[model samples]
Target: MPPRPRRRPSDRTTRARLASVLALCLVAVGSTSTLPPASAHEGAADPAHAYYGILGANALDLTTLTGTGVTAVSLEVGWDRLEPQRGRVDPVYAAQVAGRAEQIRAAGLDVILDAGLQYPPSWVFDVGGDTRFVNQYGDVWQGQVGARVPDAVFNPRVRRAQNRYLHRLSAVLDDGPIAAIRVGGLWYNELHYPPATVGDHRNSLWAFSPTAQAQSPVPGYRPGQGTTEETAAFLTWYLEEINDYGMWQLRHYRRAFGWRPTLQLLLPGWGVRPGDVDKAVAGGLRGATRGELTGALNEGLDWAGLLPRAATVRGHNEAYTTWVDAADQGTDPVYESPVRHLVRLAEPLGLPVAGENTGTNSPEEMQRSVDRVHELGLTGLVWMNAAQLQDGRWATLDDYRRLLAP
Candidate 1:
């Protein structure tokens, strides 16, 4: 039989057909086999919450955050951008920051101003170039090999330069609406030296300069790559110097602000792996497991010494790497608490703790991370790089808003 010539469908009919296909696709995606059942207790919106905020880059839209129950905004002011010249603060950049802070304050939202010390003005490196950290290979640590921060934190000259910027910054942003200031300049945005290797790329050990060598607590300490003890001592010296630098920055901020606003120091949540340090050290790194190594290696944080100096301490954990969703980890807080160890240390000191999930985190992961903050009884949760949420992560955002609501 001859096939009947098919008639062209009308525009209305085509539109209806397309709609039907889309509806069916949505139904298929929503089928029980594809999605877990929504639980009543999972992520209900709460109306009362202490503080729900978002972290952003320059020029945040205050309206968007204010409407979403965000009580605070956290942003960074790069030293490299504001004070490229050694000991000279840029007035233009200062005004820009002050203006933005004023706008955020006018909107009735608290502000957290972070000034990075690790990534400092290039000229500072030039001024103290000889003091830049030296790696195991005697190679001067530069940004190229993960040795970014000039290893001059221990130098009095560098400290004076840092304080000068702080003094100038406080003067410019004077009387602006800043609720707190986070002082940190570690490589990954918290307090820590750059790792020995950033993925397959081996980096040199830092602070091997003659100045650092002379200041080392362990005499005859060589910075070159060697056995476990050398690495351990070098790591210890690095921690002590950085921790001291962190405290130094905190004290200067306190003096500049006159205790008008809270100051925060962020400590990385390296994890809670309690074990024997001597055993871990005696056993070479290859023999020492990750758990043993974490406990022994992380002693550098010395939160006991640093946390007391700040008004409040916030733990910043990279969720993409540190947190696993409850669904994936059987709803265990152990799997979810990125800063469990930090929380333990902060709680006893009567320090109110806040948390943040930085970098790229999936919407589902974001929900779990936010929930973990409250579950741990921390003060608040700030989601970093809020611009990344525009890609239909509102469902996740809404869940966070509800979870954070009182």
Candidate 2:
């Protein structure tokens, strides 16, 4: 077993409070803060209880993973496929999910339902309450994903549909051999804004949607377009909304799924070009407007703000399962803890943390990820794939097997 991860000192007292914030920004959303803690995950941080698994275990030979120290499958059961209509839960599709779970259980593995809530249905956009995400250029994004995903985080009509889907889907899997539900977000299953690849590329802000603007903290202020203080205040509100979106789902899942299975998330790595998440406040990301910090800012993530808030969800059973991979030994400070950063932030919060390698990185890079998975006393690691093993990228599957083996 790996040594448990340790947390470093951080100032929890520091926050930039801008007085110009309006009252409308305080819109009350769902609350998990009141739920009594029921997700004790048995061996959350205990190193001896570490688990090893495959994410898309259904794709590659299941037999290859069955007896190889792997015990779980992180399956992305897309919402669009399950509930294609607004108020209906497709019986045939629901049965298909149960069958898939049974099949994995039959293989001697448990299933972690990756709640693909990000998979919006066609009918939802039709019910439109400014349901699409409008970038600054007014380019309404349906995301690169094939679904007509909605701006559910800010759009109440869309969120109500998503809420219904969550409750329905959770009730379907509530009594099964499911292990946990990885609370997904608006695309890629990671909680963040869709890559705003307009003029400035991924640096574009996505909070310009009509529902978003009507709800902005300051009526006329836009992120990066206002005074420096106004930009800071707007950025703060934007990040908080993103954080609340995550909590809203976690709370909704707990209500429908009950406290049986742990509710978790798959967060992306810090993707800014300059790499310092601190630059989110003061740095260069010059776009059509100035003060634009990409990555965490545009992406709507800041684990410093997120991890602490996550722990409040049903007390400790919430986890941090990685949907990210390592490009090298994350030991390279230049990479700024790109891989282990989330793990470190979450460790102190007592939220169970884990790892995942997309299997698309270089063999050496993947090998380093395996090293971190084994080294960090995380809940466990899930290989989100294995086409690498199939395509002869590694000399053999044993490259992964041995690291997993005692």
Candidate 3:
């Protein structure tokens, strides 16, 4: 070939651009930045100690939570947020959520994801409708608290849809990189009343969904007319279903990441009895003989056996000292040491447990509650309402961090 004339600088510039474009393509195809390592509590050198966090940004100011030297971040994700419409997940929200998880992981902090089914979509309820009670606000002050019914939980069609939604969420987050997962929170609030009630209505809130009610396997059992035995059976089935769902998520996460994520149960209102231990014992088992019902209603359910492999079980004790102080009027010895009974109920579970909402606003209350938690060998404690952190009333975040330090 004949010698070619020298090319112009413009031709050289074009070649350089082509080379840069090829390099960018290769970088996008082959190279990937590794996600920061997750910091889980179970794998820590000191398993007994744990730093507490809050439920999403609502529980605490995000700015403060990140700056507080917290090792973990807990947040509640609602069903509505996960799947707003049928089979249509919001990619924007999902990306934002995943980004938050990635950010927490990047910061070398753990993330706890809490999910719940109590709140139904607004479309499920209507004014003067049979399922109006499904709405969060249903005339609280008046004697009429609405019907307290949501067709979604009980309806088979809705249940299937909800289950599918859960599966989609699992698929999205399984590889998104998070530490812990709390599959339940105040789960029984709408299912069962605070104290044991006689009617099946209280126990069958899940039946509010027509689809669930229709597909219910129990024969000859009307939704509201079912007896306590029938209700118990229904709850057993429901809880088993939920447990399976949780296990499915855990398995998916493990299959995707080759490591089991922490599982947790966030109980509503501490899951503890309010009055004296003897009174609670009696109240929990009204008609049954002594020793029939444990001091707490939850103790009667044998949750530990149902979800034996859960990594953590956190209770919410909003008024610990207030309840204890009120119960002090009794001369009964059982009332004097309610914490002892509380600890006894949780000891056999063999999993890390914590108090999510400690009612220790005062120094004395904080000290007493901390002493009781330590005496019981509980894992740790988390205070609700991060705004209180700056109040300087009880143990602040710094104080709790120090107390839980390894």
Among these predictions, the greatest lDDT belongs to: 2
| lDDT value, residue 20 of candidate 2 | 11
lDDT of 1 by residue, 233-346 (tens): 755566567778876766687777666565556554333223323443455433233322233243244554556654343332111111222222112222213354445445
Q: Write the per-residue lDDT of candidate 3 for residues 41-125, one digit (tens) a residue.
A: 1221133464455433333444555455466765445555667776777787677566666666666667765443443344434
Instruction: Assess every candidate by TM-score.
Output: 0.72, 0.79, 0.54
**Predicted structure 3, TM vs. truth:** 0.54
In angstroms, how far off is 252's CA in candidate 2? 1.2
Where does model 2 exceed 4 Å of error?
Answer: 1-46, 59-61, 146-148, 199-202, 271-294, 315-324, 327-335, 386-388, 394-396
Off by over 4 Å in 3: 1-48, 56-69, 116-119, 123-154, 171-176, 185-259, 269-349, 358-360, 391-395
TM-score of 2: 0.79
* lDDT for model 3: 0.40
Arranged by lDDT with the best first, the candidates are: 2, 1, 3
- lDDT at 38, model 2: 23
lDDT of 2 by residue, 1-406 (tens): 1111111111111101110111111222112233222222223355556766665544555677754777787666767778886678888878777777777777888787776766666788877678888876677876455234688778888778877887787777755756777775666566777653554544667778778888887656644455666666767787788888888877887777777776667666443322333344453233322113223467676667877888888733644635334332223222323445555556667777776654444556556665655455567767645554566654246666776677
Which candidate model has the greater TM-score, 1 or 3? Answer: 1
**Model 1, C-alpha of 170: deviation from truth (Å):** 0.4
RMSD of 2: 10.8
Which pairs of residues collide in model 3? 56-75, 151-208, 151-209, 154-212, 155-209, 155-211, 155-212, 156-211, 156-212, 270-316
